[model samples]
Target: MADNDNRDHNRRDRDDRRRNADGGRPRSGGSGQRGYGADRGGNERRDWGSKERRGEGGDRRSYGDRDSRGGDRQDRRRDDRRSSGDRDNRRGDSRGDSRDNRGGRRPTGARYGQRGDDFTGGPRSGPVRQGFREERMDRRAAEPDLPEGLDLADLDPLVRQDLRVLSKDNAEAVGKHILMAAELVDDAPELALQHARAAKNRAGRVAVAREVNGITAYRAGEWKEALSELRAARRIGGGPGMLALMADCERGLGRPEKAIELSRSEEVAQLDREAAVEFAIVIAGARHDMGQHESAVLTVERMNPDRKDDSFSGLRLAYAYADALAQAGRTEEARDWFAHVVAKDEDEWTDAAERLEALD
Candidate 1:
């Protein structure tokens, strides 16, 4: 009986030691103190064997709450990573939205003089806007070849003064072209026109450049171009000096009625003596073009063509009068006036000498 009791006590001590080694949990398929089939305060412990079989490790309480604390820390770390990723996604989305709001994509092949946003894809800041303007100005028209050693100082002082609005380099280039146009106007009128066009392209706002271009175009027989340039110059400069040329351009364009209209404008009375004489010549020519021979004759007669004056204007007036009389069928009177014009026209400005020969 004593041996059986000792054996039972030793067996209980072995089971307790095994439970302590297994973290004080009951062994599987055994009933011992605090066994799996036992209840603690009417609540059974969780089945750790089933949990381990299902890959859930074991009860967190069995290992002194290590798994519970570790799981909570890991869960917090995972939540932090998820939140950080969400913030990054939001930032990326906002950047895309900003790009769309700015103006999406830039237009391809946008030309010069177009709006600034067409090329930039958005509203330009100050430096960018100024750069775009410079690019527009740099896209200049075709320019003529400038002669070597040509002096910008040779340009008229008044014209140079007008070019002060331009940059120094641009003014110098424009002045050189204007001087070349003036030099070649009467001799190589077509080449003069190219130079004047170059000057006008560089200094379009300058009235003298437009005026020179108009005169060069007139000499080149580009009547319509001459009319347009003269009109632009008149609008910018506000003067009557080019009124006669404008009237002549009207005549050249087959608008003799328009020429007559220009002759009667208030600007006519403001013309200088030379311009007035030239205006009279153009008006008489307009009358002749309209087949009003007597009216044409009277137009030049009002200018008082005199042999004693002998000036350039006087010579041109007398020649016009003689031609008008010839057109009016007053043969003897025309012959007499033509003879007088030939005597005074030493500069040979008129075809009066030829008219006299034709009459004879």
Candidate 2:
């Protein structure tokens, strides 16, 4: 019995040693269980397995390296694309800025005055602008021989010639100088005309001074004198527009009959469309007032009605036609023309319908 117990104890001890070597937990010596070290090693193996899920070689270092490298490459690609986009945007902005600068930097006024500023060209600016320039450049009484009052060096090459003709000390020079300054004061037209007359004895004979005198006389309401000067200008180099303007001045002075005669004159036949319209409108109005209804209708019919699309004159005559028709007791026809004007939104012709309605 002693030998049997001893053999059983030896068997248990061997089994315990086997369990301890295998890294398992030993519950009891006789029960043949494992040690604490065996449990710890098993836990460490489980940690390694968890790490191997995301990394090679069973460690977190491998996963960290992969994630860090991938992030760096992606960030570099994004930075490169952003910088390229920024560069492209800058280039487009520069092109747009350059275009805008070019447009605004050009001198528009200088170009507009090109024809008038040219020495050989008749003059700078239209009639109104030229008149204004002459008024401003006229020498003052305080400075005699130098009438331009402006520094010659500062004057544009364009205006220099016109200024030169104005600097002489003759009678015309003084008269023109005073007249030009007087023009700045609209109320001094008569006084300036007197000054122009006085300068005549100084300069031998200046037609320009005579013209200035004539204009001043006209400004003072001397219609006969205006007609005289304008007629003399016409005898010289009067253009179509100039002739028409002279005719308008005569008409304004209560001489529409004389004005109408000039329009049919051989030399004034080349009047521009606008001047023709003006002449026709005045003639029509004149005939209407003089109780010449047939003549007024003929006057309107003479205008190029097709050009209505290009100018206001056609429409103007249309209203006049409607008025004449109503005056002649033609209500139905007049209403059609008046309605046509209304359809086109002509506020000026709206009264034509009311006139026709009065007839109705």
Candidate 3:
């Protein structure tokens, strides 16, 4: 009986040792002791098995023992890191190879007023620029002398004073050219135009320079140049004085519609008698251009050209009226006007006698 009791005590000691090795808790019916499964302070502690399955508890470094879902999370992190590295490498490549941002290169190709590198035709050096400037100076220095028999005494004092805006030498050059232009305008219109152009190159902003240039251009049959210079003159000196010439230039350009439009400005009403007559003649010409011959005759009739006025403009207006009347098939009235023009045209400036003879 003593040996039996000793054997039973040894068995109990071994059982207690096994329980202490597990968790130092008392054993239940079958399993040893439920670790972290008991309620403590109304909260059940998480089990070690569940934490190990999630790979988040005490065995955090045990990647080999991780479940399939944890393994997928690891793979996703690796892919994200690789993708971010690829994006950084692409940005570095763009910065390295884009020539526009490298080596002090401009992003927008060439700068303003600078020619591009592809042009291979011209010698675009500093010597070329200097040569152009020197050539221009030489041409200006060699401007032609004023013609002989040209009168400067009759030039308007105000017109001479206006030339003073230039340098002393330039003012003298421009003044002589202007005087020559005025003297030669009626006889040598092309030479007058050249002088006017020279004066304009020196003092273009002067109203009288622009006016002389316009008149010379008109007489030389340069309608566009005449209109441009006349417009400049009118802009500087606002008056009805240049409107007739501008309308005439428009007519010369075959823009009779524009001529008629300009002739109807409020300035026309305030023109002096001669200018009004000239403007009326341009309007009549514009009407004639549009195949409105009777309207042309009527336009000149409004001027009331008569024997009382023996002026050159009066004779020109009368001749214009007669020409329009003849164009409109009014023969008798045209014959009477031709006789009137023949009576007043003392210098025989018009061919009215031949026109009347043709009518007879």
The TM-score that candidate 2 achieves is 0.38
Which structure is stronger by TM-score: 1 or 3? 1
User: Residue 350 of model 2: what lDDT?
Assistant: 50
1-360 in candidate 1: lDDT tens per residue? 999999999999998777655555433323222322234443343322223322434432321122221223333545665565566666665545323343332233343135443232323322455576665466454567787999877777777777775668988988998888889998999999999988888777667788999999999999999999999887666656498888999999999999999987888888877788889989999999999999999888888887798688878888888899999999999999999988887777778889999999
Stronger candidate by lDDT (2 vs 3): 3
Please rank every candidate by lDDT, starting with the best. 1, 3, 2
Q: In lDDT terms, how accurate is model 1?
A: 0.74
- For model 1 the local lDDT of residue 344 reads 83
Off by over 4 Å in 1: 1-141
TM-score of each: 0.62, 0.38, 0.60
**Consecutive 10-residue window with the lowest summed lDDT within model 1:** 62-71
Distance (Å) between predicted and true CA of 210, model 3? 0.8
lDDT of 3: 0.74
Cα lDDT, all candidates = 0.74, 0.52, 0.74
Q: Model 3 over residues 39-88: C-alpha lDDT tens digits?
A: 35422223212233323334322112222222233345456655655665
Residue 206 displacement in candidate 1 (angstroms): 1.1
